[model samples]
Target: MAEKKFRSGFVAIIGRPNVGKSSIMNKLVGEKVAIVSNKPQTTRTKIMGVVNGEDWQIVFLDTPGLHKPRTKLGEYMMKQASEAREGVDAVLCVVDGQHIGPGDRAVMEDVARMNCPKFLAVNKVDVTTPEGLMPQLQQLATIGFDEIVAVSALRGDNMDKLKDLLSGAMPEGPKYFPDDMITDQPERLICAEIIREKALLNLREEIPHGVGVEMLAITKLSDKLTEIHANVYCERASHKSIIIGKQGAMLQRIGSQARYDIERLLDTKVLLKLWVKVREDWRNRTGDLRAQGYED
Candidate 1:
């Protein structure tokens, strides 16, 4: 029998804010490498997740949601999304199946100019019927796509099919990542993201987007215990108060929720200590964005 050639390449997943780009990438990679939230712009940078098949490896770049930049942090995020599309084997543009709006159109148009094979994933199909998806499909038909698949990132519907299409798009090449490895994100960054995800889930609407988590220190206290100190940066003192909550209750809630996920991710007990600090318009400040790991 002839030997099989290994295939591997990068695929950038880009879409408008709150379009479930992270959710789709997580499902495709079969792991939660990026954080998810109901809020727009939950992801602040390009997160890479690697999927290894028997003879193929797919490197998925989960980029931040494409949106207008209002601050330096937003600009960095937009730049990350743009840079992720360059030098890739394919581009996977995800969009909401239920509501195909102008923002989605804008994203599709920008991606249309890219010089690579493009795949459109109409996500959240579980919530809508085939009939309900018609308008979205019709709208998407105007754009050029190599393949379009309807999927529910949360329900894993048609995920295997989507995976196959993505893997098939790869040219025969080297395995970019090992079989056991899933993501390229560092432990500190992942830890910080987990904390941020928890905060986004629990905090008020206006508070989550302005929030940034910085890993002050991460220490291996013992073989079974890891100590993580993080600072949750908000733009104003009032926002800090809201994050901390009455009698430090809200902060405690975010810490407890984050510690659970961190422990699972690290496979060790974690002592996550979080402190809420006000940086006064940190999102617009270049130094603050750099401090929060948003620098590009």
Candidate 2:
């Protein structure tokens, strides 16, 4: 009998803002490893989601969208996306099917500059027409991608084909993560992200970007329950008030939604205590950014 061959590699998902990269990551892993929002740049760091199969394990690195940086934090996000492309076995360049604009071209150009196996996934195909998609496909083809696949990350369209393409691209190697593990992020960090995601979903524009979630402490009170205290940091006092809302109504709503998701994620009862604090100009402050897990 011949020995079975096992394959494993790192695959980086890169794209412009709100191109459904995080959504695809969740679809691939069959779980919410990265936070998803209709808001652009919802992902500010590289989040790893592991996909284990019978003979292959793909560690997907979901990165922040590539864009021109306007602030210190934005610059850091762009840098993180660039760094994630290095040495990956494959690059999954995602693009929205409704329209391909300058942002998509710029991201494609960046991927072209990298020496790696690259594949293009035209995402959100369910929302666009074939006539509307031809130009985008033609434009993407001009960039010389190894493969182009049309998929709706939300609807799970043609994702199995994408998986097969990725599996073939990966080189033979031992698995980097255990089979049962789904992601590399710590539970506390994921909890913080869940809180931040709830804030992003409930709050209006500008408020979500100005906010950050920090896990102050997480204590395992018993087998069935855990106590988590977190602070929601905003860049201004008005933003703090916006998050707290009238008589803490907004804060309560955010807390309830986040705690429920956290419980589902951990499979335990979560006692989540949330508070809002103001940290003036945190986006530009190195110390503040570093404290909030944004790399300097």
Candidate 3:
């Protein structure tokens, strides 16, 4: 008798800003495929994380948080989140457990309008009580979700159960990617994101929403070491100074931290070179937006 083949499909995780959607994606994939920060709108693109199981493979997409757009870039990010729902096996609409506000309701309404197999994932359950969870889940359920799962993306609570549920919902199909692969993102893109995340962490509120990291050069120096040169582009000279810092100290710190994380992710030593440049309000410029990989 022949052995049985398994199934695989795509699952999109959507939610409002700072709602732990990226955290849940990282936890689900067992790796940091998406960057996590306390700041809102940190994730600005669609990232693919592959979860391999004994009998199934799930290609999970971590999208930018949905919100009311105030700029072209914000609108693009929202569009990316909306587009993820078009042709996926399942939609995991993540919401904060502690607070069920209008933002969560707006995203739930958008998911309902998709008319797909949707599930509600209440994240940050580690911070919520059983009593609080009940009301939140009940409120979200009324918005028309097919299933509900409570999970703590930070603590890994109920993540396995969530995976099982997602895998069960996938249609019978061959694996989209190999089991050894964890993500479909390019190494340069990942490196750029790592640098950007480090900036986001270090700069905090000093930087604006138009910052982007461009990998200018990457070269293998030896079997264990690589040389990388990247430029951080901002909308103004003042923002550039903020990123570069006094006596270039801030940029050095950002580069060191980012290089350490990149080395761990790539499993090799890296020499990171960082530069800050002003693009003069690049967020609204078509050419600049395309260069930053945000062009839709």
Candidate 4:
């Protein structure tokens, strides 16, 4: 059998908060490697989602949203985003089709310094009209990108073209990940993120950004059932009360919702037990942040 030449490399997706960076990455890799939430800072670490074609592979890097650091956790997130650009084959500066502000400018400036081939991925075109999307296209030209791809990660619009563009940038190399691998993240991390995603979806806007989920233990008790114990951490005691909700209704809801997703991911019945804990100033403490899987 004649072996075919392969192309594979890392491509970092850079953007400000709520610009669909995680959504775009999940769409490209065809899996939910990174959690999605309406609130900012949903992705705290660098998640690499692998996309394998017959002839090429694209390792997509989903990074934390570029922002000014307010605590140790925030500093770690910002550092992860910066470090993700260091040795990637290409960079995708994903942006919203409509609002481009100081935050977007800051990300663009940082990505420009990466010294790698950069592509402007204008996302959310489905929500905006041609007139609205036109300005985003025209405005991005001044930033100097190797290519501009308009895509709606939510609807999968023009995603194939975007994938082709990224694959075209891949250099001749061996597959960095196995063909069946969609992400490099551990199953435990995915479970934790799923719990956090449910919390973010059900909790209030004020609580979503401060919440983090830690997978205490996950074990298969039987071939058909898996047991998982996790703790949801917050910054204050009052926040913990809010998470637990009145009469523990909120916590039950979070557990119920998270279990469904976890079961789907594991393809087995799940016994998900959730506990709300108050890790006072956890985001600022190195020990607490590391426990939540946010460290390097």
Q: Of the candidates shown, which would achieve the greatest TM-score relative to the real structure?
A: 1
Better candidate by TM-score, 3 or 4: 4
User: Which parts of model 1 are misplaced by more than 4 Å?
Assistant: none
Candidate 3 matches the true fold with a TM-score of: 0.94
Write down the lDDT of every candidate, Cα atoms only. Answer: 0.90, 0.89, 0.86, 0.88
Task: Please report how far candidate 1 places residue 270 from its true position, in Å.
Answer: 1.4
Alpha carbon deviation, residue 142, candidate 3 (Å):
2.2
Residue 110, model 3, lDDT:
82
Q: lDDT tens digits, residues 227-287, model 3?
A: 9998899887888888888999899998999999999987889989887888876666777
Locate the minimum summed-lDDT window of 10 residues in model 3. Answer: 202-211
Q: lDDT tens digits, residues 1-296, model 4? A: 99888888999999998899999989888888899988889899999999888899999989999888988888999899989888899999988887778878878877776787889888888888888778768877878788888889999998889888889888998888887888878899999999999899888867787898888999999989999999899878888998999999999999999899999999999999888888877788888788888867
| Quality of model 1 by C-alpha lDDT | 0.90
Residues forming the 10-long window of minimal summed lDDT in candidate 1: 287-296
In TM-score terms, candidate 2 sits at 0.96
lDDT of 2 at 131: 88
Candidate 4: list runs displaced more than 4 Å. Answer: 1-4
Please provide, for model 2 over 1-296, each residue's C-alpha lDDT reduced to its tens digit, 9 standing for 90 to 100. 99989989999999998999999999999999999998888898899999988899999999998878888899999888878888899999998998788878888887877787899999999999888888778767878789999999989999899889998889999989887799988898899899989999999978888888888899989988999999899988888888999999999999999999999988889998998999887788887777667864
